[model samples]
Target: MGASFCSPVDERCTCSLQSTIHAFRFPLWAVKVSDFLEMLGPPRPHHRLQEEGLLHEWFPGMFVIFTSHQWLSSTHPDPQGQQMEVLQKALRGMIDGSLQVHEDLVARSDRMNLSNTIRQHIAEGFLFFDWFAIPQITVRKDGVNEESVKSAAALAVQSIPAYVELSNVFIALVPELTHKDSSALVNYASWLSRGWCRAELWCRLLSNKIDTTVIVIHSPTQAEFMFPLDWQHNSIVNGNFTVESDRAIVVQLGETAVESKIQHLQVHGPLRDCRFYCALRPKLLCQERADRTLQKFLEDFRFGSLEQAVKDTSGMNAVMCAILSGDTGMLRLLAESRADVSRPMHGLNDLGYYDTQTPLMAATKSHQDPAVLTTLVELRADPNGRASNTKLSSLYMCRSAGHVRALLEQRAELEHAALHGAAALAGPDTLRELLSRQCDPNHILAGRQERFGPLHAVALFSLSNRHAVEAAKLLLEHRADVNSRSSPSDEFLWECRKARMRVVVLGFANCNMMTRLRASMSGISPLGYAALVGHGQLTQLFLDYGADPTPNDRGDTPEDLARRNHHYHLIPMLATFAT
Candidate 1:
């Protein structure tokens, strides 16, 4: 593919011999701003400017950089002056081998192995930022004007995916920012809310590769890394500013992700049912999988065996489809062919996906009949496989469907994740079974706290009165710690604050009228969160169990949180246990 200044978008510009695009050469060892901007040969070297289509194939070592609009300082001579300063500092640190820009916090908890990939990219790679790489006529020295480069710039926008695909890592330079508009833009939420930003994110996540890395730079020292699954829940739902065109692009992106592994659609959250809509979209768009049909699926799919098929293809198998769709005749036919019942699936059913899970996990998520689970268990299918990716178990997935009993009977491991998940999601009977099986009601697990007991888990998920009352009663009966020194969920509370900011930005007549907000919800207890969320009965229960109503690490009492959130009714009850 010879470099052709092909004008797919403009008529004025031709592949004129005189026209040349510029790409800065920055060695990973020592990055000097001056050296990076020096004029190269007349024609652009090995690197393809964003104007050239399918650049990722040519420049597979480039970095797909992401940042907030705040980085574009309007007051600076160059809008990207601040961003360039930060990048220069980062490059210098990398050269000195002194700075390890921390990967996103969520990546640390994921199984994607993203941290290592980012480390490699930072140690040796190139940059593909549009601001510097794509020549702006106004900034160019060759007497080029905006009109002269209009077609190329337009083509550059169309080549974003190629740029992203070729890149080694997606670096999001997100600082804690407060923009003037705040309309779909505030801090990390700001980058997440933008349509183009999401398109870039999707390009990386829904790519043809596995274990992709996304680096988040909160500050020069506080850079974090994350994987696609870590951000799927928020990314799928937080599109308040997305237009119809963006939605169409998102649907195409999602289809590509799903085609890689159908279970990719299982990730969802509590925002506007967008996850469901996004998943169902490919079907309406008539998007077909790569293999086209079931027979072709089996013929072309590569894996070790039936078990590996479930693991690799994520239950996109014809036999699994039959089992999931309740086609008993088809299932029987497959069974007659010596189908393995112990095969674990990594796919999505109606409810969710269970990564590294057995057929029992599938039956559990799909809410299949008790008979289905029984057949698998009787066939010696292991119920020991946990849903590692989801951080929840097949047993936990079965909670809302009341299938916990069957799993308990089959002896699923009553581990910390299982117990904690049950604490948040299961009923009294499920909790009783778990406790009877030697699952500790006071088991310490990572959540809001580094190691919170089951009671703390219950406090966060107690939205319904029946769930709150019965589950709390069961835990307390089993000697649950009401005054457990659990750390409050600053992460969740911060997200709440971001949601509030979005409300203020889009709701208020003038966003500037809103006062500056604080970001420290650091030390809330079970009682404090309960009070803040306005759960009066749960507060009384905590008080009954002798939970101290004194001030927490942040010096705010349950009474204070209750008053702040306007749950005045809980104040009298909480005041009874006064500090």
Candidate 2:
């Protein structure tokens, strides 16, 4: 079969070149919403504003709405004209109490009601729109006001975070429009990926508001209130378009917001939103999202129900939450309340989602505090619990040698597959600890088939990880078998032989010979894999440690494989020992 092609709509592989190129065109100046409502004549054209570099100031408590679109080039009545009608209706609903503001954000008591705050601002109807308000300079000209305009625009872009913070309400206007490629212009997935849209989104989320809700307008008639935490499932923040200073601002904003203990419980009934929020944004800037603050704070508080305590959007119960946040006290409370010790949390965040874990599994992976781990083990949580997707146990996710020892104290499985995962992910110290514990250094993942050993795992790890050499050195020092072969099953050999026969019958003998021969080979040693992937250092390391350069079941030596794969530099080194 032919290889499958990636479609433009495939989010994982394809990004819009048009959207990426135009992300820098942020509106520098905007007119007040009230000004737009009171305009008597056709307002001065964009050309005039571009020439003058003049703009009106936005007041505190003003409503700000951003649209992910360029100015209309057509003379026809624009579809965005309908957005004004929708905003007006929403405003009316907020004022009359017909529509509910975020239930969690609205005060339960008489003091500091967010609903009232929203109503007061809706009454003013003052808004900040980029196109109607911000001066748009299409091009630069030789004049005094030209530099002034550029400077003003620069300042406005720089102050976007502050602008979003000051605005009482934020709206994302994404109406469906036809693209030149026959695709919809205002898709939530597409709009969310744009650098400028993400910048606006982060500005609002990281703003000082304790309970921020973004209004997303999908069409002229429909709109929805989106939880800011929902966007954390992906990279919703723009890393580019803005400068390093701006990126730093976003990081600080996330840190500060996380510290406030995200108020998601008030917005959504169950702690699911909060659970999802915490899971997605834990402990890294660009690599992950943020830290765990909200879950840690709940230790001092009481929940109304077990459902509230148990229901996590990402499948984490209060027990797992406590363990993940390193809150020993919270863990004790949940355990005492008869919370299921073996409950699996399916993390929805970008980091830990694939590896759904039991409370024990979460603690084991975090390698945070031994007290937290000891408490879970005392509570009878399973140390050998596996994630639903990855099928990896707690012992496989140990962060360091100390963590491995701690899990070992709790009686974690010390088998070959488990050791393989540990060697692949952990540093040299962790590997040494496992080896010292009498865990076989040359152990293979499978029994009869002999899938892979420590050196093979080390070879794969070296491709991406910086400490591959050190890890290899550690395994070598532990006397891991350098030339241990990973044997394939008889079933695989039969399938390969059959496929090779078919290829030869079809008159493509040479084309499929090498591929089928490699496939038919019963086993490959550490040096074989090293030569296959073209890691010269790792191959040399194996050779220095006395690896066998002998051929496998298919009569192909390490040198022959490297030469076949066009690794000319490795041929000389392999030739040093190859007969």
Candidate 3:
């Protein structure tokens, strides 16, 4: 296949652990992967990374990355009182039993009692592997300190044979995973093919970066997603992750090297012709394509395309690498084999597809997957296929989603895709499945970039608010119009302030890492976008939820928009919630 693909896209071939006692056998050397996943910070009052607004998620581009500095932390060579007397003599060799239960105990207790304070001081801390919930199917029920899961299971039995040689090169290149969450999809390649949980409870959950995210079985047609591949599989619309091209990988059990793991493997299909695919990269053309072999190149094109009129200038053209990997089955096998399916194959230094599309508008990208937009509308592909939001099409992105009405009820015509909004971007099931097919959850979008209106489309937004308050209580039980029939009125927080600074600098933006509440800018509400952005306790949990101190005809109020935006670090908690 492309000359039997032999590694070497070189970030120094990913390995490093001069003293690997067990941080997952310390590898995947240059470690910096975050096309959005930076939440691991709270172990015991360790806050200062600019106090981490921290509510994060989305890694649907399923990943694997490795690197470790190991952690003897009290400054080594018997320093903090001889490393607390060698962790109190390894907790008397774990209370006189002699510690074994290996399989990479967080890479096998990197040289004992995992830095013991008699098992990290137990008020309810210790057990590991809790990155975004779903591994052996739910841990952290609070119970793992067997001397910190044994020193990361002797560094995960030397990092599970380097992820079984990188899941044998992504299970011989994406054959479509094989079938339904294939055992929670590779469960980190079945936690290193059934050796499961060692490196002492995977370093007591990656040394307290105790994060979350796992989709499984990453390659034979891609799926290995550690965290955030965009979730909400059934209710409240959007970010579905379309499984079933046999199985699509979600791989990442432990680690060894190759830049600590992640080789670009998403591959969706249908919702009018979904896209994504860049499997096995490293051809190196270099003009300043940012290079470490190009980081997340728009999630695997990494940094090499700001000009694609439908890529594949040379090799590996699985439907032009699946429309440069927006990949809805190689973009419907290259638009059912025609392949130009509206040609905007690359151009995203910051959005520029500029053209028409039919492959279900190239898989509906401000984030997609309701069974790959219902298999690109049963392969006819075009549930109102037009682009740049002329009025509204992708059925307002399947009306805030119920699995895109469980796949547009299996073959299109779910009343203009449930009344259009995927472009202005909002879906609690594509707008309550377009007001349950009557099409008027206050139906706005007269022309271009239409962001919000029904008194800012109701909610109890993301970080788990329960599906935009259950699709705004089913569009206020179908009466719809929360306001804005063409507002001279405009005061529901100014429409939440014109979408609230992209939701206070991209907040509820996750998938697979699973977060959903999104829409904003009417003002003074989401407690003035969390006190205009200081988040004082998520602006006191959005003023317990009433959120309206007044001053609209534009005089400015959530404490004068937090003192005219200086946010003097959240103006003494927005002047104690404006008295």
Candidate 4:
């Protein structure tokens, strides 16, 4: 078992040329899940595993689980064996059918389940963790044979994509933990921003495997299929790399992976997916847009003619293509050719754009150029159009001050919705613009049952935005209440009950599930909302501004919310404030 090697010439090996060469040099290494679970005190180094005769070379039909994670310490992946403990328990629960992976919260309606086949695979699987598979010279600097070590390390580094492609399952181990050196909170958001992590993600998602589901293990008890839009938002070119020079190489790898995916989809006859990828190719590659003639545009996007393109209102229709490609001229041409600029988006819910999103809304949410928004408005796009599903206007999706100005210039309303939206989704510049226009930072919707304000909006929806902290600070500076509370009315409770029934129907029940539901449906403070989502920075910010650690209407305090969600790292901080 330990001496086997998967043949690089196998028909299943469809890695790129560069990846193949590197893989051929180093081959893939893994350790059986059963063996790994038994021999763990602290995370053992690769050499230690090898010396114990535990490491195994990959072979055909072997079930491989590729684990991607961030290092918590400078010299070790997990100095306290915290991550390994979680993995161990998760694996145990999975094998015993105690743990069930579900879809993310946004897509809970899909009710994607962890198949019994995957559970069986986990029972007899091998894990390909970086620290356990690759040689670690960077941490062990005093080792002998420096030159030989460098050669082997380089080979393993370059072969990562091949290993990713070969794996049967991809698990992102992104438990919220604090970085020992930088004290930064490392979680799903930070993991998504990493360049190498993105590269690996693209490789696995783009692979020719039948099942490309990415299981994101947030905690031992909280694992879900990754949201598709998470990868689309975190482009490899925009990822952060510890060594800046690795950016170019990793970006090239990303391009190859995307191109490979597109080709595979083209042959596989998922024509809708093929068209979507073709339309998003340039944006994904971060390439400069070149002027395209009408015929060239039609051909590049695989449209039969302008009529077909204009009439289609699917996720990647002609209007969407133009918006995503940054082709404003083409956008005007489409509108002139009878394309509905305000046509609600369809079939893109998986990508997070949501249904009923108009072209202007899409452009705004995507952080497209200000010129694109101006052009859409000039082309008679609805300046105040709202998504039918969420009732959020395009103004609420403004990513910058330019977007706000463009909409306002077209007579878009500057109401409480705009301030709330900007507070949760936009940066300081956009908030500044709205505040200058005299939008009330503390205004609650008149005659509305939900008491959600701008501050509450910031707490609930700004988890993924890098500028959220700054946006919250700006709102506070503009006299927004630091201790704003959200008190849902009877109507709101009815709505929550309906949603809760849906969750119950989906078989999503746990020990404290009712308590959590009650707390969420009842009134909650901004600090409570922050703790609920485990936004460490936002919680700290709210505490610094004198936010009270009071319980909600359901008698669940901020600390309770944090613990219910398995945000253990936040317990200490919230406890300090509670005391």
Candidate 5:
């Protein structure tokens, strides 16, 4: 509606909030950033700053004294440098406390990452586990091969140049990187990025392309993939063509190459399984729900219904479940009821699964009541039955120091069976004993990507920052492959990042860790990972071992990731190279 000389009262007046007008004007001093943005008057202060004697009365005007006690950075608030922190604190208070919604303005800004700025100050809130700080390998107590190991390690490290060319060779193949060598990769890319896009000249991640995939089925438990037939020859996300899935988000690279060499490849021409290891009809999809079925059986000594369980005497799983549960009465009843005490499990994809052993294998995984295990043994259950499908029998399940003395038993080597992947899941002590018994370290049982032996299994299992130190120690004493390319994904780095674990500072000739370094996508080794997540000592260790401060295709290196991830303590680590 228009009004010309009041022809018609303008309807525009009915709408509220014009900046030039005010029913009751107020000073801006009492207003908050939020209230001003809303274009609405704030609620009256409980007590005006002047009324509360909180402000100094100047000749004509007065103002509130912004004390540092109320705001840590009040005296030196660097708005540009600390905007993220300020916004995060304010947002948090608004969400959790008294601040009212600043709807119109709040919806416009993105400040989630700003919160990470403050988290940078805290320590130890984020470690997934503490086992990462410990060493993974150890020396054999018996000293059986000490001299041989020393000779091998010294020969390997001394033969290789200190500053090896990363682009030209498979560092993992060097004898210096053999099992006895003690070096590992440390990744810390997040700290290096510090949350900003890198300069273009340093090499931006233009894009990553993958148009090929190969699938292979392995029973009901797992599956495999091959990007190129020549796995040994390739490395990178889609690099030399073979590997299996680890977790959902692994940052893997096969090898390092400048932009030019990456463009040319021989396998651009050809391509290559089925059944979802699933509810997916394959073994993996809806696999055992949290190991609950096993957990329950181990706890209850019986299934949901004891009656149904008692009738199946030869059911190896039922016996094993009873033993794992350590229910002496249940075992007594089962054995008295004529259960086949000598039967073993049938699902031996490897020694880890469907292992044969009527109920003996069950007891191995369970630390149940000793009486139940003894009862099963007294009932003539085979201590050395042919296991599910492994190289050794059921006796090796008692690898624990306690279990070993209890059973005086048992063990495998099908390095590359279809169950080869599962074989990688074997226990460290169990494998160590087997290797001590002279099992071939490089034996390929069924289908294995890397023919390296038991040590690879130990290192891979320690990925979660759990059992890594002990696992590594056992492998080292036995001479596990330091540079061996294990399961192909870059998962080791992720676990390192999560825990900020530090690897040993073994010399470079022993840099079997180079493959692990190259396999990771971001410019981080496990040490870099630790630094980004705020582990200073880990950063030092990796630097000593020569963790390169190189960035990936994105020009975001370990130092960059650490800062961005709010691992402020690690920022100074890079200063060592700051000439």
Candidate 6:
């Protein structure tokens, strides 16, 4: 029989046929929070949980928490029960209002919080952990009833997305842990790279749930709402899998999720969101680009006419659509019809392209062709324009040497901030172009309170860039200081306090206290920034270059920052290089 299909808008629809089979063959099992707390000693298997009468059938409004994580071993997900301990402490903290779910450092503006209502629900919730929910028959040596056991295991695996959709909260239990067999550091980064984890993430984010926020638990005391850009950058098609054969199946699942999300939004009446999803559908699916005619484009984007498209200045306006679609001719046509080439973006923050960013900035960040940048400039888009929210020039968003050249040719000002931005966001080619223009690698902004150099910028902002190491190396080769410290002005601290007070006044949780405290403090060296983010390769590179591990103004050394952030894997390395 062909694969069973279901409407994405259906609240009770299962996306896959295997998940439907799973309903009868292997039901989704969960454990109550109170009962889970009572389980003593090592982590138990599904059979033991069922035997102990701890497993319960998940039902509507049961407040199920679906956990996504990386396996620590081939046979066991948590060989040492370390992850379980962290989860237990975190849950207890949530129930008692001790553990505050903070926003990620980069997502302070999102104002994410775990409300008391949700906390109450979590206090009376059930957990769907794969180890405790799925049959662990594959690890058994005996082959008795092996086919039935294998079938059950496969069905459970396929039903994971359905379970995720049924849950109220999604938690990524990514506390820094060591892999048993490979001795690899299994943490947030490693978990993000796993194929199965990405599938679970897509399932939840693309689900029809009203609140699809993912809580990433880094340590017992530290948890944050995930930055949307993380999932957007790490597509399931690019995720690593233990078995290569699983790639095809998982990729298919991802396509279904994406399609379902787009269809649901299209039918649902948030026209702006529908347009955003439709425009990004190709990129999300990893499909080859197929150029569309202007007629087809307007129809697909739900525009009544070309005039309607041109007059709009929303997030996915005519100019933005043309830029994303890679149609330079359409961009020119829109400009000719009085479309504001310099209009700031709005209502697209969920996709990581923030508000107040110009079309030039979006094009630069999206790494569009150099020709696209040239076309925008030729159409009178300001090359030196800065985002109103961030005060960052379009030059700061350049991804490649060509982008820099395109902006520079239009007289985009090359200053210290440009070098800092290039080191953090761009590749080696872009950094090389900026340095060749004699941009100082260690030039601290004289007036700004956040006077950070190029090296410091790389450490703080280059988390997702694969070219971060090479970009940093380029700066170091240009004589950037390995131990240059940040000098936050007193005004910076005052402003931070004001911002915190504003958050309090607005009745939002102060989820950025840690980040604010770090920012207000002065004399944080480049090494400290790297260690704060647990960038192993960059930290080692700084150590190899003789970076001093001396404590900063707050008396927190690089090792202290690493340990505080639960980067235990970096402890030995930092200790060996400690001054």
lDDT digits (tens) for residues 1-579 of candidate 2? 000011112221111111111123344355444445544433443445445543444533334443333222233113335435444554555555543332111011111112444455455544555544443354334453876766756655555655555554566654433343333333343456545566566656544343345665533223345433234433434434324455565556445444333553444434554553453345323343223344544542234455567543345556655665566766666667677777666543322333356677566555555666777877888777777754667777775777777777888777656567666656777777777788887777664242678787776444333356677888788788887876655565575566446545653222222333334344667788667545667788889999889676666688876665434447887998744
For model 6, what is the C-alpha lDDT against the true structure? 0.76
TM-score of each: 0.46, 0.50, 0.26, 0.87, 0.31, 0.87
Query: Tens digits of per-residue lDDT for model 4 on 300-359?
Result: 778899999998766788888788777888998998998887778887765666778788
Task: List lDDT for all candidates, in order.
Answer: 0.48, 0.53, 0.31, 0.76, 0.31, 0.76
Sequence-dependent TM-score of model 1:
0.46
Candidate no. 6 TM-score: 0.87
Local error of candidate 4 at residue 220 (angstroms): 2.8
Give me the candidate number with maximum lDDT: 4
Write model 5 residue lDDT over 32-118, tens digit each, in one string. 223222322221221232244332211111111110101112222121222223233333332332222111110111111112212
Estimate, for each residue in 466-538, the C-alpha lDDT of model 3 and write its tens digit.
2333444455466544323222223433433433444355432211111111122322243443333333443
Separately for all candidates shown, the number of backbone clashes (residues 3 or more apart, or on different chains) is 7, 9, 148, 0, 73, 0
Better of 2 and 5 by lDDT: 2
Candidates ranked by TM-score, best first?
Answer: 4, 6, 2, 1, 5, 3
User: Positional deviation of 559 in candidate 6, in angstroms?
Assistant: 3.5
Query: On residues 1-579, what C-alpha lDDT tens digit does candidate 1 reach at each position?
Result: 000111123211111111111121221111223343332422232223424422232332233333323323322222324444545555554444433443223222211122333434444445555553443444444555667566555555555655555554466665432333322223344566555666567666554333234665533333344423233433432444435556665555545544533334333222212233333333323433121233433333333444444433334453455444433443444455666665656434212344456666666544455555655665566666554444455665555334666666788755655666666655676677677767777776653333467776676545422366678878888888777755435465555366346535653211111111111134556787677545656677888887887565556677876665445557788877664
Ranking of all predicted structures according to lDDT, beginning with the best and ending with the worst: 4, 6, 2, 1, 3, 5
lDDT, residue 66, candidate 6 = 87
Q: What is the lDDT of residue 209 in candidate 3?
A: 18
lDDT of 6 by residue, 506-550 (tens): 422233435433533467888898887767778888988889987
| CA shift of 462, model 4, Å | 4.5
For each candidate in turn, give its C-alpha RMSD to the true structure in angstroms.
Answer: 15.3, 17.7, 21.1, 5.5, 26.8, 5.7
